[model samples]
Target: MAVSFHVRSSSYPSRQHPQAAHVDEQLTRLRSSETASSSSIRQRLSNLQDLHDSLEKMIRLSVTNHALSQDQIEKVLDGSIKILDLCNVAKDALSQMKEGLMEIQSILRRKRGDISAEVKKYLASRKFLKKSFQKVLKSLKTSQNKNNNDALAVFGEAETVTIALFETLFSFMSGSKACGKWSLVSKMMSQSKVTCETDANEFTRVDMEFQSEKSLQMEDVQNLESCIQDLEDGIGSLSKSLIKYRVSILNI
Candidate 1:
C-alpha cells in the first residue's frame, strides 16, 4: 500500500521569470520618460533668465543715450547765447565809429567854407587893382608930351608884373579846385559809415596830398606878393617920371 508518487519537474526556462522581466522593462521606460521631462523644464528656465538679462541691458543703454543728448543740447544753447552777445557788442562799436566820422565831416565842411570866403576877398582886391592900373595906362597913352614914350614903357613893365602876379593867384585857386581836399574827406566819411573796418590807410594818403597842395599854395602866395612889390616900385618910378615931365612942360 506504499505506492511510489513521483513529483513532476517544471518545463519553463530555469534562468528567467516571465513576470519579473515584464516588470523590469516597464520600470526602465518610466525612468527614461522622467529624465526627458526634467531636461525640457531646465531648458525653459534658462531661456527665461537670458531674456531678462537682455531687457536689463537695453534699458541701461537707453538711459545713457538720453542723458548724453540732454547734455549736448545744453552746451549748444550756451554757445548760441555767447555768439549773440558778441554780435551786439560789435554792432554798438560800429555805430559809435559812424558818429565820430560824421563830426569830422562837419568840421571839414566849415573849414572849407572859410577858405572859400578868403579866396573871394582876395580875388575882389585883385580886380580893383587891375582896373586902377588900366586907367593910369590909358591916361599916359592919350597925353601928348616928349616924355610920353618913356612913361608908356614904364607903365607897360608895371602891367606885365601885375599880370604875372594875377596869374600866380589864378593858378593857386585852380589847384585848390582840382585837388578837392574837402571832397576826398567827405568820401572817406561816407565809406566809414558803410563799414566797420578802419580807413586809416586811405585817410593818410588823402592827408599827404592835402599837405603837399597846401605847401604849393603858400609858395604861390609868396611869389604873388613879390610880384606885387615889384609892380608897386615900377608904378612909383613912372609917377616920378610923369611929375618931372609935367614940370618941364610948365617951364616951357
Candidate 2:
C-alpha cells in the first residue's frame, strides 16, 4: 500500500519581504527628491546661460561702437551694471546647484554606506562642472576689471589732451611780448613739438592698449563659451547617471 503524503507552505512572506519593501520605498523617495533637484538645477543653468549670452552680445556691441555718444555710453554702462547683477544671480544659482548635488550625494552615502558606480560618476561630473563654472566666473571678472581700467586710462588721457589744447589756445590769445623774441619763440616752438610728440606717443599707446583689451575680452568670451558647452555636456551625463542609478535601485 502507498502511503499518503502532505506538504505545508512556509509562513514567511514570498517576494514582498519587509526589508526589501523598506529598501524599495526608500529608493522611490530618493528618486523623487533627486528628480526635483535636477529639474531645478537645469532651469537655473538655462537662466545662467541666457544671461551670459546677453552679456556677451552687449560687450560685442559696445566694443564695436568705438565712437559711442555720451548717451550711448551711459546706456552701455547701465546695461553692463544690470548684466553684472544678473551674473550675481547666476552665480548664486550655480552655487545652489552644487550644494544640492552635494547634499544628495551625502544623503545617498549615509543611507547606502557606499553608493553605486553611476552615482559616483555623477558626483565626479558635478565636481568637474563646479570647477569649470568657477573658471568661467574668474575669466569674466578679469575681463571686467581690465575693461574698467582701460576705460579709466582712456578718459584720463583724453582729459589731458583736451587741457593741453586749451592751454595752448589761451597762451596764444594772451598776446605775450615773448612772441616777438626769436629765442623765446624758438624755445616755445621746441617745447610745443616735444609736447605734440609726447601726446602722439601717448595716444598711440592708448590705442594699442585698447586693441589689446578688446582682444582679451574676445578671448574671455570664447573661453566662457567653451566652458559653457562642456558644462552642458557634463550636466547631460550627470542626468543620465541619475536615471541609471534610479533604474538600478528599482531592479534591486
Candidate 3:
C-alpha cells in the first residue's frame, strides 16, 4: 500500500458527508468489540461487511466521485487490495491450524506415542505463521508513516477506518505484541495457565493448554478445531464483501 500522501485540504475530515457519517457509525460499532478474541474479531469483520455494503451504495451514486478524487480512488483501491491479501493470509493460517489440530486429534484417538512431538509441530507452525504475519505487517507499516494503516491517505476518509480495521484484525490474529523476539502467542505458550484475562482468545487458550497439558487433551483440541472453523467462515464472509467493494470501486 502507498504511504501518506499530501493531505488535500478540500477533503472533509469532519466526516460530515452522510456516507462518511454512516461509515463512522459502523466503525464505532466495530470498535466497541475491544477484546482480542476470535469472536470479537469475527463480529468486527461481519459489521465491516455491512459497512462495505453501504460503501457499495455510495459507489453507485454520482456523489461518490465528487467525494473522492481520481488519485484517492486509486490509493484506496491499492490499499483495499492489500487488505484483501491480508484476509487471505488469515484464512490460510486458520486452514493450516485446523489441519494441524486434526492431526493431533487423530493421534489422541489412536492413543499413540508421545503427543509432545505433535504439539511441538503445531507450535512450530504457529511461530511460522506469526512471523509471516509480522513480515506482511512490516510492509504495511512502512506505508503508514506516509499513507497506510495507522496513517492512511489523508484524502481517503472513506477508506481510512476501513484500512485501520483490517490492520487491527490482522494484529490480533498474529498476536503481534512482542516480548523481546517472541510474539504474544509464543510468550503465552511458554507459560502454564492463561492468567491474562484479555489474552484469553481461542488460539491462546489452545497454546497455553498444549504447553501445560501432560497429555494433550482431546477437549482442548476439539475446542481449537471449532475456533479454526469459525475463523475460516468469518474470513470467507469478509473476503466476499471485500471483493464486492473492490468491484464497486472499479465500476465508479
- lDDT of every model, 2 decimals: 0.30, 0.32, 0.62
When sorted by TM-score, best at the front, the candidate numbers are: 3, 1, 2
* Predicted candidate 2 versus true structure: per-residue lDDT over 1-252, tens digit per residue: 011112235984334323323333432222122111223334433433332333223223333234345554554444334333433434443344444345434654476543344334434544554465445434332111123333232322222221222222222112121121112222322323221111222112322333343322323333323433444443444334324432332222
Evaluate residue 147 in candidate 1 and report its C-alpha lDDT on the 0 to 100 scale. Answer: 30
Q: Deviation in angstroms for 150 in model 1?
A: 17
- Of the candidates numbered 2 and 3, which has the greater lDDT value? 3
State the lDDT of candidate 3 residue by residue for 41-159, as single tens digits.
66766786787777666566565555566766787688678778877887888888898888888887888866788889988998898788778756653222243332223224434
> Which is the winner by TM-score between candidate 1 and candidate 2?
1
Badly placed stretches (over 4 Å) of model 1 are 1-114, 127-216
| lDDT value for model 1 | 0.30
**Residue by residue across 1-252, what tens digits does model 1's lDDT show?**
011112234874344223323323432222122111112222322322232232223223333223334434343233323323322332333233334333434545565545434444444443454454344323322111123232122222222222222222222222222121112222322322211112222222323333454432333333433333433333333334334433332222
Q: Which ranges in model 3 have alpha carbons more than 4 Å from their true place? A: 1-21, 142-171, 174-197
lDDT of 1 at 81: 38
What would the TM-scores of all predictions be?
0.25, 0.23, 0.73
